[model samples]
Target: MRIAVVGLGAVGARAARQLASTEGVDEVLLRDIDDGRRSEVAASLGAIATPEPQSVTAPPEADAVVLALPAGDHAAAALPLVERGVPVVSTSDSVGDVEALLDLGPLAEAVGTTLVLGAAFSPGLSCLLARHAADLLDDVTEVHVARAGTGGPACAHQHHRALGGSAIDWRNGGWQRRAAGSGRELCWFPDPVGAADCYRAGLPDALLLVNALGPVERVTARLAATRRDRLTARLPMLRRPHPEGVLGAVRAEVRGRVDGRYETVVYGAFDRPGVAAGAVAAVAAVAAVRGDLGVPAGAHGLGASTRARELLGQLAVRGVKSAAFTG
Candidate 1:
C-alpha cells in the first residue's frame, strides 16, 4: 500500500517512519505545510515528501492517506481526500459529531473509500479495555478512565499557565467540566510499568464508551503528573498561551461493576506530547491503509468508534507496551 501521512511534525514524522518501515506498505508519502520539514523527514526516511495534500491525494499514485494533523485540522485536511475517493484513517482525537462525520459515509461509499477514526493510544486503548471489561460483565454499572503522562515543555507550560487545554469528564450521559486534579487519586499497578498514582480528569473516550455502552452509575477521568515540581513551576502561567512549554503524563483507569461485583482495569502509555501525538497518527494511518476502522465523518473524539482495544493490541504487538494494573 502507498500511504500518505499528513502533518510532518513529531507525531506525523513517527507515523510516516512506521508506515514506511511496515512490510506491506510499498511507499510512504510525508506531507506538511512546511516544505523544509517535509524534506527533512523524507530525507531521513527515504520516503516521498510533499507540501500539498492534493499532491499526495492525487489519483492512483497514493492508495491511502493517514492524517496525523492537529485535532482541529482533521475535517479540513480529510475532506479533500474524501473527494478524491481515497480511504483515510486518522488519530486526530477530534471526531466532534458522529452523524455529521459519518455523513461522509455515503460519499466514501460513492467513491469506494473508507474513513476510520479513533485509532490512537488513549481512545483506542482505553476504549478497548473498557469494552473488554464491559463484555466480561453481564451488567456494567460504571466505567472510569485515568491517563497520566509526561508532557513536553510546551504542554507543561500550557498546564501551568492554565491556557487552553482543560481537563474534561464523561458522566451522566454527557461531558462535564472538571477542575484539574478534581478526581480522586488511586494506586494503579500496571504490568511492566508498575504502580503509580492516578487522579481523575476529563477524557473524550470515556464519554464515547459511555455513549456506546449506556449509562453508568459513575465514570471519572483523571490526569497523573509525572513531575510535580516541573508542573508547579508553571502553575502561574495556566491562564496564558504557552503551547510550546506544555508537558505532562497520562494514565487511564476504567472500573466496571457487574452482578454486584467490581472489576477494575488500568492502562498506561508513557511518552512526551510529540511522541504521543505521533503514536496516535501512526496507528490511525496504518489502520486507514489496512481498511480496518469504523470512524464516523464529521468532527469526532477518540470514542466515535469501538475499535480502541483492537488498536491497542496492535500497538502492543508492534512492541508498544502499555502498563496494566489489576487489584
Candidate 2:
C-alpha cells in the first residue's frame, strides 16, 4: 500500500517513520510547505519528498492518507481524499468548535469515506480506551479522559487556547458548554507519573466520544500537568519556555459506571509520547487500507471505531508498553 503523510513536523515526522517501516506499505510520500525541512525529514526516513505543494494534494491511488498537519488544516487536507472514497487518519480536528466536529458525520457519509478523526496520543488512545471500557459494561453513563502534558512548543499555545475556550461536557442527556478549567479533579495515573490535578479542557474528542458512545451523562477531557506547566499557565514571571516533548510518561484514564457498577480503566505508556501518538495514527491509516477497521463511510474517532485490545496489542509490538487498570 502506498501512503502519504502530510506535514513533517515533530508529530508528522514520527508518523512518517512508522508508516514507511510498517509491513505491507510499499511507499511513503512526505509533504510540507517548507521545502528544506520537508526534504530533510523525508531523507532521514528514506521516503519520497514532494516539492512544497500549493495545497494538500494526496498522491493518486495512495490507498490511504495520514494527516499530521495542524488541526486547522486537517479538513481541507483530507476532504479531497474523502471525496474520492479514500480513508483518512487525521491527527487533530480540522474544525475549531464542537459543532464543527460533530458536523463531519454527515459529510463523511455523504462522501462514502471513512474518517478516523483526532487520532493522536491522548484523544486517539483515550477515545479507544473509552470505547473498550464502555464495552465492558452493558452501557456507559460517563467517561473522564486524562493525559499527561508533554507536547511540543505548539502544545503550550494549544493548552492556553483550550483553557480559554468553552469546555463541552455531556449533561442533561445532551452536550453542555462549561468554562474551561471548571471541572478540575485529582486523578491518579500509573506509577512514575503518579497523581496530579486534571482539569477540563476544550478537546474535540470529547464531542466525538459523546457521539460515538451514546447517551453519556458526563464527559471530560483533562490534562495532567507538571509544576512547570502550572506555573507557566499562571505566573507570567515564571513562564519561561521549557523544552518541549521530553516527558518520560504518557497516560489516559477512563472512569464511569458499567453494568451499574462503577469502574475505571487506565492506559499508560512509558515512551516518548510522539512515538505513541504517531503510531496510533499510522496504525489507523493502515487499518483503513486493509478495509478491516469496520467503520462505514462516516466520521469516527480511532477509539470508537477500532477494537481497543487490538490497538493495545499493536502498540505493544512497537515496544510501547500500555496496559489497562481496574478498581
Candidate 3:
C-alpha cells in the first residue's frame, strides 16, 4: 500500500523513511513546498516526490495521506484530500484552532472520509497509551498524562503556545478551564530519563481522553522539562532543538476502581518524540490503508476511535518502546 506524506519536515521525513522502508509499502510520496528538499528526501528514501501535495487524491487506487505539517497547516493540507473522500491522519492537536479542526468532522463525514487527528506522539501514542491505562480499570475515574519531550519546530511551537495559557480539563462531568502550566506534580519516567516535576498544561490529548473515557472525575495533561528548558520556553526567539542525544518520553497514570478497589494503571515510552511521532503517524496511516484500524468516518481523537492496546502493539513492532505497568 502507498501513503502520501505531506510536509517532509523532520517528522514528515522520518515518517516517510519508515514507510518507505516498510516491507509492504508500495510507495512513499515525499511532499513539501520546497521542491529541492522534497526531491532530496524522496531520492534519499528511494520513493516518489511531489512538490505539490495539496493536489494529492486518495481512494479507488491510492491508500492514505498523512499530514506532518505544523498544527496550523494541517487543515489546509487535509481538507483537500478529505473533500475528495480521502482518509487523513494528522499530527496536530486541539490546542490551536480547536474549532477549525473540529469543523473538519462534518466535512470528513459528509464525504465518507475518516479523519484521525493528533496522530503524532503526544496526541497520538500518548493517547493510545493513556487508553491502555484506562483499560486496567473497570471504571475509569481519572486520567493524568505526563509528556516530556523536546520535539521539532512545530512541536516546540506547540509547547510554546500552550504554556502559561488557559488549560482545559474534564472535571465534574464537563470541560473546565484553568491556568496552563499551573498545577505541578512529580512524575517518574523510564530509567535514564528518571523523574521530573511536571505542570498542568493545555494539551489536546486531555481533551481526547475526556471524550474517549470520560464524564468521569478528572483528566489532566502535563508537560515536564528541566528548569533550564522551562526557562527557555519563556524566550521563543531562542528556542533550541532537543539536545544532541536525548530521547523523549510519554507517561500516563489512569486511576479507577478495579473490581472493588482504587488503583492506578500506568504506561511509559521512551524515544525521540519528533521521530516517534512520525512513526505513530506512519503506523496510523498504514493501518488506514490496510483497513486495520476500522476508524469511523469524521474527525475523531486518536484515543476515541483507535484501539489502544492494538495500536501499542503496532508501535512496538515498528521499533517504538511501548508497554504497560503493574506497579
The predicted structure with the larger lDDT, 2 or 3, is 3
Positional deviation of residue 177's Cα in model 2 after best superposition, in angstroms: 1.8
Clashing pairs in 2: 128-303
| Whole-model lDDT per candidate | 0.56, 0.69, 0.75
Cα displacement (angstroms), candidate 2, residue 162, comes to 1.0
Locate the minimum summed-lDDT window of 10 residues in model 1: 155-164
Instruction: Give candidates' CA RMSD values in order.
Output: 5.1, 3.1, 2.8
Best by lDDT: 3
* Per-residue accuracy of model 2 over 1-327 as CA lDDT, tens digit each: 888887776677888888877999888877777878787876786644333453644444578888777557667666677778788887773227224434666877897778888787777767776776677666666677777654544444566566656667776576777766666688766666767787666767676787677677777677665445544553333353343476535455555666678876666665565677788888888988887665677878866674676876787787666666655
RMSD of 2: 3.1
Q: Rank the candidates by TM-score, best first.
A: 3, 2, 1
Give the worst 10-residue stretch by lDDT in candidate 3.
53-62
* Cα-lDDT of candidate 1: 0.56
Off by over 4 Å in 1: 47-61, 83-85, 94-114, 150-167, 184-203, 225-250, 257-260, 271-280, 294-310
RMSD of 1: 5.1
Q: What is the Cα-based TM-score of model 2? A: 0.87
